[model samples]
Target chain A: MEVAAFYGFSALAILAALFILFSKNLIYGAFALLLAFLGIAALFVLAGADFLGVAQIMIYVGGILVLLMFGIMLTQRASQQDGPSRHNRVEVPITRRLWGFAIGIGIVGVLAKIIFSANFRMSGDAVSRKSTIKTIGVELMTSHLLPFEIAAILLLVALIGAAYLALNRNPAQ
Target chain B: MSAISIYHYLIVAAILFATGLAVAITKRHFVGILLGIELMLNAVNLNLVAFSRYDSDRLSGQLFALFVMVVAAAEVTVALAIVLRVYGHFKTVDPDKLDELKR
Candidate 1:
């Protein structure tokens, strides 16, 4: 049962990622990313990182994906609106497409071979355990405190920078 | 049957990372590239979480994954804002056309 669930979610995530990469329409890709993120979150849960999985859903699916969709919708050219489906189509040069496939396949083959052959020492208690939310919270407040505070500050700075960069006021004015 | 190992998670992460690389390389849109980058970051997070779960006693991997998510969020925010700026200045977001910095 667990294995089946894992396969289901992983397949969903992988297929959605494929769509995100291969789809021509930007909006369609963005929508596909939603499913991909959800699948990853599920995988996180299956891996016993329950808190991180929820955080993934909240932060990624809730915040970042919305931001991406807005960016895609706003940046389209005027000429793009004349066509229905072609408006946000990706225009990859033929040479670049061939090169991308070659590099991608090569990396995947190498990495898969390495992964299949590598020996990983396993913790027997990893999967059967639950209540990871408490462990994560305790760790965040204790050993990970400094980095947690720093991440908060980093987020604030990024928020301010994003607002400044996206401002539309004319500098001459 | 044996239980799922770190190898399974690692394989998924590898596939995801490779796909992100492909998307980053082949896509013309700046936002598409950003999405690719997000995919790559998620793959790294998956590896971190998996290793933390399977190999370590502490929750260090999950902690690092949380940090990675925070960083990825910041990156996407700043990157999208820059993409918007690029569109405002050049009137187009095509990376190839925004070769003004080259010359």
Candidate 2:
């Protein structure tokens, strides 16, 4: 039963990811990415990483995707006529595409080989265990406090920096 | 076939990474490249969380994934702001036309 759920969620995640990749419209792609994020959060739940899953949904789907959409909306005019022309130019050299493909495939192949060869034993029964939010809180505040605080600081800085950058007015005006 | 393995996640991540590369290469819009970068970042996060699941060191991967998420958020914010400024200045977001900086 759990296995089936895992496969279901994994399939959903992969499909959403593909949509995010292939979708031509930037807004549609961001929406697709939201679906992907939700699907992966489900996968995280199936894997018993409940806290991470919830955070994934909240931060990624809820917050970041919205920010991305806002960015897209704010930067581009709404007329559909402008969208295609803005994206129509062939900027990348053909050789760069070939190089990117070669590098991506090569990296994937190498990583796959390395992962398959390693003996990955499941350490505990965490898969079956419930990852209550309480445990995550305790863990975050305890041994992982430094990183937790750092992440908070990072977020604060990001917020301030984003606001500053986005709000900057033109001096030449 | 019977179960989802780590390799399965890896494969998904690989495909995602490849597609991101494709998007980055083919898309001329600055935001399009940003979207591709987001996809790649999510791929890495997926891999990290998957391994954290199977490994004994609980929460390490999850912790790192959280950091990655925060950083990605920061990156997008700054990048989009830059994109906005670029658009304001250039009147277009196409990378090909932004070659004034190339020399």
Candidate 3:
């Protein structure tokens, strides 16, 4: 049963990702990315990282996706003559498209070969079924305290920097 | 009938990462590139979570993945603000059009 669920969610993620790659409409790609994020979150739960799964949803889906949508909407040109669908379309040259496609396929082939040949003889026990929130919380406060605090500082800097950058620096354009 | 193993998760991550790389490379718009980058970050986090499944003792993988998420969030916010600024100054978001760096 769990195996089936894993395959289902992984397939959902892969398919959604491919959809984003093929879709020319930026809005469509963003929406498909939302599906991909949900699928990954489900995989996190299936892999026994329950807390990570929840956080993934809240951060990636709730926070990041919304920010991306705003960026897309805010950056669009006001030229409505080309229709709504074409307004946000990305025109990639044929050669660049070929190169990107080849690179993507090559990387997938190399990584798959490496993964399949790896003799991963794990020394630890199999995945524990317990909720990871407690372990994560405890670790964040104890051994990983410094990095946790550093991440907090990093976020504060980002908030201030973004606000400052968005402000109008020059009055006369 | 074996269960879902690390290999399965790794394969999914590889595919997602590759697709994201392609998106980042081929997209001309700044926001489109950022979308691709977000996909790549998620793929890496998925891989980390899969490995952490085995090492349940310390969970260093999950901890690192959380930090990665935090960094990605910060990156996206700052990137969008920059994208907005560029669009305002240049009247175009295409990276190719902006040839003069100090115009």
Model 2's lDDT to the true fold? 0.73
Best by lDDT: 3
> Worst ten-residue run, lDDT, model 1 chain B?
B50-59
Distance (Å) between predicted and true CA of A79, model 1? 3.4
| Candidates 2 and 3, the one with greater TM-score | 3
Candidate 1 Cα deviation (angstroms), residue B24: 0.6
Q: How would you encode candidate 2's per-residue C-alpha lDDT over A58-166 as one tens digit per residue?
A: 8888777887777777776444456555533334556766775676677777767777787777665345365546655777888889988888888788788878877
Residue-by-residue lDDT tens digits, candidate 3, A1-173: 99889999999999999988888888898999999999999999998899999999999999999999999999888875475467788788888889999999999999999999988998775657777888899999999999999999999999999998877777785
**Which regions of candidate 1 fall more than 4 Å away from where they truly are?**
A123-125, A171-173, B55-57
What local lDDT score does residue B5 receive in model 1, on the 0 to 100 scale?
73
* Number of the top-ranking candidate, with DockQ as the measure: 3
Model 1 per-residue lDDT at A36? 91
Sorting all predicted structures by TM-score, with the top scorer first, yields 3, 1, 2
**Every model's TM-score:** 0.95, 0.83, 0.96
Worst 10 residues of 2 chain B by lDDT: B50-59
DockQ of 3: 0.77
Candidate 2 docking class: acceptable
